[model samples]
Target chain A: MINKESVIHTRNLSRSFGEILAVDRLSLAISRGEVFGLLGPNGAGKTTTVRLLAALLQPSSGEASIAGYQVGIDDQEIRRKIGLLPEAPGLYDGLTAEQNLAFYGAMYGVEEISQQIKRYLELLGLWNRRHEPVGTFSKGMRQKLAIARALLHEPEVLFLDEPTSSLDPQAARLVREFISDLKGKGRTIILCTHNLEEADRLCDRVAVLNGHLLALDSPIELRRRIFGRKVVFHLSATKTEFEPILLEFDFVNHVEQIENKIVVAVDDPDTHNPVLIRALVEAGAEIRFVGELRRRLEDVYLELMQASEGIINGTN
Target chain B: MERIKAIIIKEWREVFKNRFVFFTVSFLPLMITALPLVILFFTGRSEDFAGVTTADLPPQFSSLCSGLDGAECMLYFIVTQFILLFMMVPVIIPMTIASYSIVGEKTTRTLEPLLATPVSTLEILVGKGLAGVIPAVVATWVGYLLYAAGAHIIVSNPHVVNKLFDPLWMTAIFVVGPLLSLMGVSIAVMISSRVNDPRVAEQISGIFVLPVVGIFLGQTTGLILVNQEFILWMAGVLVVLDSILFYFAVQIFQRETILSRWK
Candidate 1:
């Protein structure tokens, strides 16, 4: 179902090159101001999906609309409403940083081009070097300039493909901070990346794709759906005797004992934990502490990718 | 229109900075214009054609130079020969620039970002086309004026100097020169779209100049005469060729093909 509040909507969107399907039967609705991530390994159609949504490439099948404008039909309008930072910085090395922004700003028919160029240049910390040719810039500087160019037009939607792929740690952090700042401005951003950590930190929801939609949800929710919630109770002694007691509770799905710790898989850890602790304490148990097992977004991403591979292998 | 202007301005900024492009646009026209003037200066001061008459001239040029002295006829023939060389200015200069326009953007990986903008494909092609044509046409006209001024100073015969302003040369420089530049740019744009290397595109597009060179050869060998009718016919053919080449260029420059298929 299409959400009326969605800024970007696609249904059964498929794009293929010759016999190889790059994106297959993918459907998604990205609401306004949401940072949606497209995550997958190489050859997973992440870039292709961004290109399709940006209206740089035509979809082989299905429909997409961005900012209420249909793709393929209103491509120029869609282009006007969106900004794309391609994988490569793709700057003109011969032109100065200010000239680069001025050219793109004019292409978008941006008013007060100089002011916009100054605003983004200062924001990206490249204002002092605006007169220098891009060829003289470092890799990090070029990436920052490219970002500024994308945002100079104040686009309603921004598509960033691997915005921090090649940067050093410090540069990457700066870019991440910039993206986070944009998030606060309530502009819808579609980030295509394989950086699970980046996605987990920046995305409200992410779609794991491998030429097809594998999974889509918030990082925490995907972890919960894949691994379920587990509460670990640290006991004062050997925990073998507490496993059966925890399993006796109907809310506890499964229980395992390992080295003075009772790991209980429960549906609702918040409410079930207190009741389980009470039962364990009443049954002559000494619980040292209680904590919920946390899974990283990396684990969730790996599990989803493994399961996708398994299904493909099983079908073959 | 603003988008097109932006592209044109962007292209000029980049093209002006390129050393090879600057050299070709500035020096080639000056050289073409000067070489003929040097030839006329030296030949006018020499004694080789001092005592010659209409009997000594080629049969094709004998009647054309009947009223002129030997040196005057010789100077007139030399100047007419260089007219086709002036046409070469427009063809070669634009090919130098237009050949690199699209393919250079591809090698630099800037085409994707440019295409992602709201600018239409036609606007881009037109902008790049004009960027290449304007300089070449302007240089050709300027070089012709320099040659005209230089010829009048070097040659004492008024009739021979007057031949430079003939309607044929006027039409060829003013009308045919711009068309040939457009034709060259269109072919370069088309070749640039399909080829991966700008040098390769330039080499292939350079083949278009051979026909003009062949005409020059034929004119010098008395096999073909470049008359007013010939200039008009060449302009007509260029108009048709430019139209066909531009249509194919737009068709081949599809956004999907460029983003996906360009290696």
Candidate 2:
């Protein structure tokens, strides 16, 4: 039986290929029914981490588990419980979409595999053309079939590596929505992708990894902790008059007013935003709109990569 | 066992769907078999072709002729010599199938998803190995059977038929043919695992047939005689070699190698 807590657990898990350390001393815990994202740049061990946890590749040292089964020892067991959509959909061009799904379903020992195949193919909007060879389908359709193959066994954990990397915007949206739907069913998912926006929207907690875990937190928490908080307030009155009053709070690092909008950078917007709002209203500045101007997850990701580089260069 | 069966079924589906591989595996043996018959048909009809007598026949050819006339002796010699060419079929057909199936999967990037499954490496290799070997074996036997029946019809002399259907040729085509196919599939698989290009694997695997060609050359040149004893001994050697090659083929087929090493 799978552990109710921490469907995936790792302790200092590391893997090296000759001189190159693909994944280094990684440790993490992902609870059941959580959608965790592994955010990384190319060659940052994101795929390697997924492969390691999926039991496709064994770690050189340390230990890891999927659904309470040890990675190396219970590799077949772990594989039995996990599904993977690799960077490439890797479907056989000669086989039909339904045949491809049936092949994988049989390999995973999925019972009533034809029904499972039909279910996933229909869910991905591929039931209409399931009999057509995958080679005849577009890239997005092939990817959808690959996704269906991964979920055919109804695996306990799903690992998606760059699920929408080469897809067009509309196709990407379909795959993202499908992933969101999977999350709604309380499925445990580990998505490794470079798309920060998708990660932000889907992942409950994103782990920024570059060979190791650099930052692991909710997207909102990561932005607040790394870049601090900046709240933007638009007022009907000219905001130049409210700057001094907003700066009175020590947590407010800087206050800038551009026409009728006040942009305040604060250490903690959750605590200071309300206090600043009350003062703004008390002073009789007509507030038209009040909202937090959070930093984009992309900016946070780049900053983290740059800081990690600085540490690697011994300049920090 | 079911996983292996699934892989084998998928492999057959893929092989048959590929026109070039399917044609090569199914028709190449027939083409090769036709080559010798065409040569025999023309060699018998050509005005310049002088029929050799029993005294003029080579020592290796004389044994097959035994009590035949001069023209019959010539046809007997031709039929026996062409059987050596048939051996190349098992090697060529299976090598073509195995190299293309293994390396073609790599080129298509389909191997990754298959590797990610819990199917053991042994099962995958065996499944693929049999998929290639079965068709080649059947083709070899089928082509041989066709050639034998055609030779009986085309060659009027009974001596030619007698030499073509000898126990030695029977063992070579039926027993040694499948073993050579196994060896060919194993060598192709080993090369396929190391290389990403199917063409490269196919070219390198062609080297496995050089020794068989040497035997062919030796027998035809009267340097080494091919008799029933030689056929039985060769079968023994091939069965042992096939087992060893297959064992190595399985050992070398690492899922990690396919997943990580090959780009």
Give the candidate number with the greatest lDDT.
Answer: 1
Candidate 1 collision pairs:
none
Per-residue lDDT of B73-192 in model 1, one digit per residue for the tens?
876887678878988889988888887778889988999888999999899999999899999999999999999888888876678878888777899999999999988888888888
The DockQ-based CAPRI class assigned to model 1 is high
Off by over 4 Å in 1: A1-4, A235-240, A283-288, B46-48, B51-71
Estimate, for each residue in B1-263, the C-alpha lDDT of model 2 and write its tens digit: 88878887888888788787878776788788888888777764323335556677675666656677666777666677878778888898888888989999888888878877888778888888888888888888888888887777777666668777768888999898888988999999999989998889989999989989999999887887888889999999999999999899988888776788877
Interface CA root-mean-square deviation for model 2: 1.1
Query: What is the RMSD, in Å, between candidate 1 and the native fold over all Cα?
Result: 2.3
What are the RMSDs of all candidates, in order? Answer: 2.3, 2.9
**Chain B TM-score, structure 2:** 0.89
True contacts kept of 2: 0.68
> Interface Cα RMSD per model, in Å?
0.9, 1.1
Alpha carbon lDDT of each predicted model: 0.88, 0.86
